[model samples]
Target: MREEKDARIIKREILPYLAPGIAKLLWGKDDKFFAGLEEIRLRIKSPLILKIGDRDYTINRRGEITTRLDDAYVVEGEDIYRSIASISDNSLYAFEEDIKKGFITIPGGHRVGLAGQVVYKGNNICILKNFSSICFRVAREIKGCAKGLLPYLIDKNGQIVNTLLISPPRCGKTTILRDLARMIADGIHIPFPHNVVIIDERSEIAGCYQGVPQLEVGVRTDVLDACPKALGMMMAIRSLSPEVIVTDEIGREEDIASIYECINAGVAVIATVHARNIEELERRVLFKELLKSKSFGRGVVLSRRQGPGTVEAVYRWDD
Candidate 1:
């Protein structure tokens, strides 16, 4: 009964802020609780838990869960709900699964992440049990973020320009990379002419939910999601016949070797790394290789001014 009341309260309170399609569903009963945007997302992942305190929780690809709290309220069906008073409802955030650098394996591998407070215990940071709010960044795909970055990648001599895109947090760096793959795959008429192969270690870039791209990556991009960068790169070379290899977040031994492999094969590469500037990239041993090898031809760096998801700046590594 209390849960039902909470659900009703949420519907009454939240509908005003939701988009029209979602607001309509929240108002309807049978259809409301079933197909409404909120339920639609929850139905995709059973036993969904929305944190109402301050903390983080994670469910792995193998269905193993590790959370700081011993208990969490689960939302199973219509009559279930919980309420948090005076919490900001429009804040944007990502699910907890993203921290693992992986998406959730919900029944169909649909992922969910929880975000809130970080409780630290002397070198150990854990999520708090009192979550005042949560951020749900649905892992959907927009296939054209990379379209603008491709031309710069192709050099004047009919070869793809070596490029790097760097950005802090959510500046659409990955989104751009995804589109670049599509353009390359579609036989981008850049100076460097080659089909593109995407090495997507995390499901983020391609949003590969079911061994297929959730975003439109053009007709030519071939995506290898959920594999380590190194292995994925080699796989692209040995099997995919790619002229260009792209990936997100490099600076690992395994990843460096794969970058070397791509260059050795005379393939143009585009990838992103986490750094404020060329200096931070050097802090990581993996990045030092980039400086020494001069392997990556271009670099893009991003900054988030106020918070995550806010796009701030795009820096060129090659420049």
Candidate 2:
């Protein structure tokens, strides 16, 4: 029943943005395809692609991906428009801000990546036009992924530690972050729950739809969905009195500065950054201040060597 429910959610949230023919083609596929489906890529004049697990397949017009050119389905501009209308619910103006960011979060926490011409005004992106491509990244929550890291994130007193997750893109940084947030909020591996404020800049961590989180973050977690990390961190600190502040993909100078402030305020932080390993993390000029200050007492590195969310190594500041 749970699996069926998940499938229904995906179909309802994602299929509307697809052209009728393409939608029918995808819906007609075997259940196995949807079981591990990760992303759907649509490019104008190019083949329709599906990313399932770690493999990519090009879907044909007949609802099958094959080696023969005749079997491959080519995407069209009309498909793009139909998808845009579907995603925006026919009101593109309402999502102008998200479009400028090159992505929009549909219901069920699904994210649609957009690409096309960019319109800028005074060094800021004002609009996106002439859409040519779309990538729908399906969101999944693996509840136990954070269990392995719980030992490292908690101390003897049952207090959450100041931790930072490091990984390259597609290494499941956000996935682990989401899981940890749940664990922290639920008091898993700890004596009692802590107040956790999530600065969910991309809405990926909490998957908020209409201001409500679609994913299970935990009973004690408060999410600032789609809010900038830097600003949200400050806001969480000032108002939430959080014992732990959680966020994903921290790279900006302002973000680091805010983390410093949070640490000084005695709030433990769990955050992620883009880096292959400890050495690379230390070498980055932007991260130098935080690294030198030892703001993050513990570090967890992730990779796809085994699979997404694979824990390569865990480090302590004194290590």
Residue pairs with backbone overlap in model 2: none
Q: Write the per-residue lDDT of candidate 2 for residues 1-319, one digit (tens) a residue.
A: 5566557766787886788888998876655667668898999988888887677787776677654544679889998889988989999899998899899988888889999999999999999989999999998888888887898878778888899899998889998899888988998866898889999998899998878998989899999988999999999989998999999999898998899899999999999999999899889997876777777789999998998989999888845
Q: lDDT score, residue 200, model 1?
A: 71
Best by TM-score: 2
* Candidate 1 error regions (>4 Å): 1-102, 105-110, 114-136, 188-193, 305-319
Reference-based TM-score, model 1: 0.59
| Sliding window of 10 residues with minimal summed lDDT for model 1 | 79-88
Candidate 2, residue 3: Cα displacement in angstroms equals 6.0
- Give each model a TM-score: 0.59, 0.95
After superposition on all C-alphas, the RMSD of every candidate to the true structure, in Å, is: 12.3, 1.7
lDDT of 1 by residue, 24-74 (tens): 433544322322122122321233332322224432223333363233223
**Model 1: lDDT of residue 158:** 62
State model 2's lDDT.
0.87
Window of ten residues with lowest summed lDDT in model 2: 62-71
Clashes of 1: 31
